[model samples]
Target: MEHRALGRSGLWVSEVVYGNWLTHGETVDRATATACVRAALDAGITTFDTADVYALGAAEQVLGEALRGVRRDSVELATKVCLPTGDGPNDRGLSRKHVLESCHASLRRLGTDHIDLYQAHRFDPRTPLEETLVAFDDLVRAGKVRYVGVSEWTAAQIAEALALADEWGLARRIVSNQPQYNMLWRVIEPEVLPLCRREGIGQIVFQPLAQGVLTGKYQPGAAPPVGSRGAGFGRAPRFIGRVLGDAVLDRVQRLRPLADEAGVTMAQLAIAWTLATDGVSAAIIGATRPEQVTENAAAAGVRLTPDLLTEIDRTLGDLVDTDPTKTADMFAVKAEWARA
Candidate 1:
């Protein structure tokens, strides 16, 4: 797998990161999850992404077991905080307490000494930004977290964190930002992309296939395939359901010919497209089966010509969502959760 520098930091990550967000401990059993991780390692994927919130931390344990014998220094491990892990008021968010405690829990679950990338899953408006950055800085200084990042944070929020880190002379700066980016979901392009580009923060994007919609497996006007995310086989049908409309599925189907012309599967084409974007360090792919991991990993270095990219845009005309405000809207939802 091709490796790229994560933003301006010295850390490098695989172009295709194997992530177990919905599969491990939720949809797939332990044996199947181990097989998937094996497939990723065989396919040259050394970067593994998970979160403490996934399956309420079962995912991390599964991932840890999956990589038990593998050389720890050979792979990059990334996880996130700022999500509810328990019922207590201190069970979530990016407060200093939660952040510090979550890192330790993640370490024990992952069976690792230090996290390669520890990210804020979402911006916590209720917590002071200084507290969050300082907590991350503490982790870095204490040899628990190597680098700090944020997920689904708006450009302004990222800027604030960077500014605080600079002003406070923290030990580490934000090195990456994880967001949902794909051919259909271009919300991060208008502001987040440019800001990260200028600020030296690489984007480790998730859902590069638009929650499997870009795979062209879901046919228009037809029921979702059995065992698909939209069929409620994994976590819930909520995320994939948003893009299962006939309009979106039909347009997605139109891109199959482009994939055929490129001599790659629809999934590979979808993943490669995300890597083609500027400032993207890696694209995270989740899989239920080992074969899916092998297939998607092959898209690592697939180069799409300018004409092919233009053809893709022409095929999916007007189906893409590029609203910059959508980032803020996501943050607003998280803020509401904090209030409640």
Candidate 2:
């Protein structure tokens, strides 16, 4: 439960944040969600990340109900907007109307008057960045949201937001960026990650385990076990095997020996390995069971050795990009590897 600063915003968050993207409302029942949140809190996790679109807001309701007994002021709540709750034209994107309305809706669902962190789920090319910044500024000025952030946003988009915020005297500042960054997905490393560090925004990474791919759950020749994320109703991304392509699976298979040597699950090794980087402020961990929560919490302090990091670099086949300057080097290497 080590606390790390969320950039220069001064909001201290636990290194291992509890994320409720799946199982909270879609697969797991309310009681189970409550137990999971309690388990995370008991393990010293203070930051909880959820999205309004997750389970179409049922996730927020469940999280709000589950955390009722806990001290609200002691916890840092982070949620997102900009995703469609319905098919309406205004139901999605970063429009000022949608941003403001969505914030209130999330507040009601989350049972909180002021969200500690409010983030845009993605870059909205339709709405002008000025409109989004002004809306976020309005929320911060009205004390509805304590801070502003973006998820899965590119470095260029984030810079544009910052510039607009500066020019408009906006009350909001981009304190953090939450992107999918795991041992398998390192696309954030080259540009977006370094840009966050340069702009004083923290990197609150999501899917640090590649949704159990790094957990060694899907054996080479065996079917996925029952009740796993891939086997549950929340099964599209992980089950589609869309993200678990051969390159990803091959790298994962290669890491088994390294994880065994470290006396840690591959999940822990991957999570700790991500945190060992320079700019990650927190790692968003999705745990369905109490034991999983406890297991991932150990990721906060575990350090990867230089030798292990080197071995991981070699096996991961250009996944973890250490140098911001050589941004496209890894991509070129991947192309060459594919050709070979």
The predictions' CA RMSDs to the true structure, in order, are 4.0, 3.5
Tell me how candidate 1 scores on lDDT. Answer: 0.91
In angstroms, what RMSD does candidate 2 have relative to the true structure? 3.5
Model 2 per-residue lDDT at 315: 90
Residue pairs clashing in model 1 are none
Segments in model 1 whose C-alpha atoms lie over 4 Å from true places: 328-340
Give per-residue CA lDDT, model 2, range 1-340, as digits (tens): 7999998778999999999887688887888788888889988999999999999999999999988877789999999998899899999999999999899999999898999999999888998888888889889989999999998787788888888888877777899998877775577777887788888899899878877878877665455678776666644444335444455566678899998888888888989988988889999898778889889988888888999998888897664434443332222223322332
Candidate 2 residues lying further than 4 Å off, grouped into runs, are 234-240, 318-340
Model 2: per-residue Cα lDDT at residue 106: 93
Best-fitting candidate, measured by TM-score? 1
lDDT of 1 by residue, 102-184 (tens): 99999999999999999999999889999999899999999999999999999999999999889989999999999988898
Q: What is the TM-score of each candidate against the true structure?
A: 0.96, 0.91
Residue 40 lDDT, candidate 1, scale 0-100: 97
